[model samples]
Target: MPRPPASHMPIADALRARIKASEWQVGDKLPSRAHLAAEYDVNPMTIQRAVERLIIEGLLEGRAGSGTYVRTPRERLRMVRSRHRERRGGSPFRADMAEQGRRGTWESHSQARVPAPDGIAVRLGIAPGDPTVRTDYEFLADGMPVQLSTSWEPMAITDGTPIVLPEMGPLAGMGVVERMRSIGVVIDTAVEVPRPGRATQEEANLLGISVGDLLTHIERTYYDTDGRSVETADITVPDVRWEIAYEIGIEQPEQD
Candidate 1:
């Protein structure tokens, strides 16, 4: 048997229904917490929780020093992941944003000679404590934070090379595929596993969303033609602001 719903769930549902029915139109300020609590015959804290739920759902928004109001729904941007994107030879995130008529920019920091952790070692097929280069990126569209990425590459493959640092050297900001190619490593495939999660304090602060909001965590890795893991990354995207789309290509059969 399933457990009973939380006390706040029903309140959140009722508020959502009213918004959907147009009882509260976009940009309309909601009733005060005390007023809502009086109407629902519950504590003000209960009403606050319900409002917070709606805020996280994108049905409502809170302005500091102002009040909670119905939100104007934002059109979700589609982030396409495909092999073709990797072959484009530049910043795929920028290209993706350009396709949507938005300017894409990112702030990244790279650190070299870091020891790989146990989990990252397994993904990169290297021993724990192996030297690697790590890069952290905050991706933005139209100046709004949209995604976060942490990438790792084994130092053995790139040590002493010009592309050793991801954001510097001759191939600065060229992305993994082109940067690797500059060093004679041909990347042939990438794998991604997406999982659902809730935002933590740090992620929420950086993303400008409430803590515990919905997020999609993608574990991605790029492999060379020889099946060696060359790069691995963990990417985080907020669900309310973006939708992830995947495009697949079919291979042709050998001609007789």
Candidate 2:
């Protein structure tokens, strides 16, 4: 079997076995890398690799200014993407959090008159370099960062309107559907496409996870009654911490 790989695999397996045998309880700090290296008769780099593997597997977590510890398993939160939520009048994220007994809060910044890039332009069905209002958001649940999103709306739709700022003005934080409704846009549909990806360095830093961790990237767009794309957004969620759930409502046939 090609010499069974190398030293790190066996070292990682040994550590995993110890963890499985209750040798380290949740929140218990692991021994120093040097100590583990000496005990395993391997280089410190080898032990580091082993620990990193465990961390990626969610069995351990690294703390800054502290050491690695057995991680406390967390319940995966469900982020519901439902047509019903789209029809709701207020913040869908806040409602979702309320359903799970957690407070949902977000901080956002908006920049007006940003030129739309090709990708965003395609989603919004507008010409590239068209003016837009762009808003970036960091959403938290129970005061912990759980999601990130960036949304764009064409300036042609809401150039001088109160809802143009997204997170400011009178209709602040009411969500796309409600905000557009206030302007008589009447958003009729929303579409979302979810893709799995590796977390980038910035994403890792914000979510407090290792770089390259699993994440779900969702591209969502809302269309008005006339099928004009009114707003588009890219949403990011950590895979280890949340699961995306879609709630579909069945349409009833006409009753004679």
Candidate 3:
């Protein structure tokens, strides 16, 4: 008989076990990165990465000036997706904007330009300095600025489209998918990436929050029929009120 393979686990798992065993408790500062590095016999970067994984898993929280602390045990957060496909249809930005409009809130388009940023350029498969339409909007929900989005499009394709207009009014009634279809483009796929970061001064001012507050940075890329990039957008959502859901497949072994 072959021997079983050793299990490879993340460092966060070890730290979590310590927390659960009461070696560390809520409000207790975790060991410094250097100290943890020595204890684990690993490099500082490895320790840092482990800490980051814990932060994302909500097993720990970081204070700007103080230190990292063990998070209190709380109810496990389970995100449920809508059962009906229709209810799940539409771009997230469009859905949020529509809800805001229904609540008597509105968004103001603050910036629209043609110069592409490095990140957007790479996603759109264009030169860093290539022409691209950039549109920034401040979304108000319940009469309060709650979210901000900056969307980009390849100018060669969208510059002549009516959707490039400064006002987001026309795009309001129709979602991005519908708008793209009207222009002979079909968005067949989308990819979303989420990262954690502190809100910038401008973002804080618009969202009425203090700078350095935790925020979710979301980037979405849409691909057209020919697998060509159609649009790319970056959105910032404050951590306190935003949530996302995804449908993932889980494979189970057959019963003996």
Candidate 4:
């Protein structure tokens, strides 16, 4: 006898509840689709869909030629970025890790005289093909890779200066704002735009995650009070393992 269609969402919810309640303990294989379909009086396709949703949600994991089993999620690292911390002119990653009694380290690679593309040139207020310093950074906390950043700064401003190369100067690791301040450039503002992205092969390789995993892409630009862009960066953080927090001061409008 054919059974009426059932919503897979409710089935997924029910399975998730059981998993959370430990009824289906970690490493326990979930029942087969045939059995679930018979028990719920639903189509086999519905059962399959419900299981797939649970797999994607990290409540269950499917093995090749084996049944799906409950999953034990890894511990996540939480990071906080705030204007108050920025005033201290330290690595935000290091500060956040220190709060949790963890250590953070990062390595950077730089190239000078790299030609800026059209988009970068516009943000930098320089002509297309203008030379700039480009640097790539990989940050790890507790020896686990957590973040990646690629930044560009126009050479016209830093040419013949001691900090032209980001990681090679006496001011190495001091941060862009501080380094620029040393060179008489006072950074007044920064803007960030965060968007959801899928991990690429390189990102997956560095972060040790599967390709196509969800990630957060943040485009950040620093500008001087004169409205000139001083630096720009593309920052990447994996969603499955990190929770990014931000703090800002909101001022209320003056009452009439």
Q: Which candidate is the best by TM-score?
A: 1
lDDT of 2 by residue, 1-256 (tens): 2223246889999999999999999989999998998797777888988998888768899889999999987667778889887666789999888888999899999999999999999999999999999999999999999999999999999988898899988989999899888989998889999999988999999887678788999999999989999999999999988999988889899999
Tens-digit per-residue lDDT, 1-256, candidate 3: 5333222246678987888899987889999988987787776777777777677556788899988998764332222222222233554444544543534244655344578888789999888888876767776655766677787878777676787653554664354566677679888777778888887888888886656667878897888889998889887877645555666547799999
Question: Compared with the true structure, what per-residue lDDT tens digits does model 4 show for residues 125-224?
Answer: 8898999999999988889898999999999899899999988878888788888999999988888888999889999899876566679898889998
- The candidate 4 region of ten consecutive residues with least summed lDDT is 84-93
TM for candidate 2 is 0.86
Which residue ranges in model 4 land beyond 4 Å of their true spot?
1-11, 32-53, 62-67, 250-256
lDDT of 1 by residue, 1-256 (tens): 6333349988999999999999999999999998988788877777888998998888999999999999998667778888888877788888888888999899999999999999999999999999999999999999999999999999999999999999998888888999999999999999999999999999999998778889999999999999999999999999888889899999999999
Per-prediction backbone clash count: 0, 0, 0, 0
Quote each prediction's TM-score.
0.92, 0.86, 0.58, 0.81
Off by over 4 Å in 2: 1-14, 29-47, 63-67
Tell me which of candidates 1 and 3 scores higher on lDDT: 1
Model 4: residue 215 alpha-carbon error in angstroms: 2.0
- Candidate order by TM-score, decreasing, is 1, 2, 4, 3
What are the RMSD figures for all models against the true structure?
3.3, 3.3, 10.3, 3.8
Write down the lDDT of every candidate, Cα atoms only.
0.92, 0.90, 0.69, 0.85
Model 1 Cα shift for residue 65 (angstroms): 5.0
